[model samples]
Target: MTDIKSYMEEKLLQFEPYMLDRVQLLQAPDSLKEAMAYSLQAGGKRIRPMLLFAALETYGQDAEKGFDAACALEMIHTYSLIHDDLPAMDDDDLRRGKPTNHKVFGEAVAILAGDALLTYAFEMVASSKLYSAEQAVKLISMLAKAAGPSGMVGGQVADMEGEQKALSIEELEYIHHHKTGRLLAFSVMAGAFIGGADEQDTKRLETYARHIGLAFQIRDDILDIEGTEAEIGKPVGSDESNEKSTYPSLLTLEGAKLKLEQELDSAHEALASLNRPAPLLKAFADLIAKRNS
Candidate 1:
């Protein structure tokens, strides 16, 4: 009997210190360092990096080769969280059970911290030691597009603009796919690329990434409604309070749950094409679907 949770947690712990060390090595002013470290150290599940490692392992490659890319992804993600918590954005007060970056570091510093992380992430990708120059460029380009205006940033813009307005399912799906799904997809795709997976396998993994990413967001919406603050580590109903559209709001709670299951099924179907055991990937999908927080 394998405890997938503990397994993933151990895997997350493995490279986190590497990332922390990289952040510390930056020659920045104390305030900027503190601000950046604050949110970066404020840990979440480290799902993006873990997915990268898992995907690499799926193709019988050493996960260490993807470490730089994994760390880069996490940095981009952390920067997004910092920006998202700013007063101009979601205006969040708390994150992962603690005061948000802005709440602790002031809005201006928090914004700068996010900007620093975003730029530093590209530096990390460019300076990776394990990959060829060509591979590095590919990784850098993939991350930029995923985190750029065409992807997460664009989705955030749509989300902000969509507030107080009813969005159709197609419109909402676009938001979820681009905003959250792109990076997650990149995690898998990048991992596959590093692992020497064939094009067909990479495409299948992309489909898997899409399904899991949407399921992850849908579950987040469901948890916002059904999960307790203690469990979710933030105030529930904040979405409704912000008047933002959500899966539960759009599909109804029951409908959202059904959609979640359907997405999960679609994810598994995508995995079936791999013809290889993906215990971690399967466990990850189940975890996303069932997470209380």
Candidate 2:
């Protein structure tokens, strides 16, 4: 094993500083900047950026080359989290063991902060010196589609709509596929372009992305039930309280666990199909499958 945990920490150390630098460098209002920086500072696993870095390094490309795209992706993800924590949404008070953005910054400022980050993400990609103009455009288009109404936004709508109803496995997959999977798949594909992947290799990695994306959500559901508040960074069992259908709700806990195994298997098989080694990506799948927080 490559001690992927240590490698991940090393990449994260490089990533977090660059992410903060970009947010700090923005010409936006001090209040808005503070709110945005606060959430980015409240860290999670940074899995999206890690996935991009893994894809890049798999192709022998430098991870630093994907920093702009990675930061942009993380910004969009953080923006979504801020919005998702609002009173009208998930209504969360705690995030990453700190007060949620809306709780600390007030709802209006938090909203603006999210809007600023979202818009700034596209600008970052467009203006990055690391990528060629063509590469920037492709990353932008992919991100816009991934984050916009037809993707993450649309999935949010589906998730909310399905909250009160019984969702089939297919329907639940649809919600997660867009809400979570779209951005995740983009994380890998963005790295593919930055790393100069051929069409066939790109498709294989995408298959890998797709499988792991669902597995990530399934693990989230499992963790919601089994993980402690200290480990989860928030109250556990919110899904049950919210009356949302989860993998465990739709399938029994054991069934959900089995499905998780299936997804991981498929994900690993996709990596095995790759033309080159994808050790980091494989480690990523294992991490998602077994993560506590």
Candidate 3:
């Protein structure tokens, strides 16, 4: 397989200027805009947008066709990270090896920045030249569902609630599926939908996303136990500190690792039916499970 990491990095660099320009165009208060820019530019993986582009390419679609949707995905993902680092939430001080948004911008500005990003995500999708009105509507609906109460937000709620409380394996899976998995799934599904993928292809992509989504969180749970602060760019063992329910909490270290491998394999199998080979997508699944950071 090609070097997926390098490929994704190249795409991220290509997308960065446009992403920044779009952020600057948001007509918000200066402080809020600055706060949003701070977090958005804080230098992370840009994995969500990369996945969107990869999925688009997998379907023989121009990556530019999904550019705005990719940007919207990044905005929503960044917003989640900002809120997650707040004192009221994860209380994280550092993100991407720098001060968290709340730490750099103050809590109020950070909160507004996150809000601005979330709302602006929809606007970006609505105004993009990439899709028809119908496609934009569908993309908007998918994104809203993935980011709202039924998806990422709901998972966040479950995650917070599960902290300090013992949870079943199924419950833990539910939390991950919503909290982290949904957006990842949405990223791929949105790409396929806007790329004009047929129903069968969309379903296969969804299956591929779902398996990798769960595996991604499981790998994260293991990473928290085994990875260093430098490797993860975040605190390790935060799950233990917060007494959060996680795959490792339920299955132990070795079991979680094995489960992650199983899910990665399943994801690859799902992708096998695609009309075109998705070497990058396959490599992404492997990288997510084995990532040190």
For every candidate in turn, the CA RMSD to the true structure comes to 1.2, 0.9, 1.3
Q: Which stretches of candidate 1 lie over 4 Å from their true place?
A: none
Tell me the whole-model lDDT of each prediction, alpha carbons only: 0.89, 0.93, 0.87
Please identify model 2 stretches exceeding 4 Å from their true place.
none
TM-score of 3: 0.96
Q: Compared with the true structure, what per-residue lDDT tens digits does model 2 show for residues 152-226?
A: 999999999998899999999999999999999999999988999999999998898999999999999999999
TM-score of 1: 0.97
Candidate with top TM-score is 2
RMSD of 3: 1.3
Better by lDDT, candidate 3 or 1? 1
How would you order the candidates by TM-score, starting with the best? 2, 1, 3
lDDT of 1 by residue, 103-193 (tens): 9989999999999999999999898898899999999989999999999999989887888999998999999898999999999889889
Task: Estimate the TM-score of every prediction.
Answer: 0.97, 0.98, 0.96
Evaluated against the true structure, the overall lDDT of model 2 is 0.93
**Cα distance off (Å), candidate 2, residue 271:** 0.5
lDDT ranking from best candidate downward: 2, 1, 3
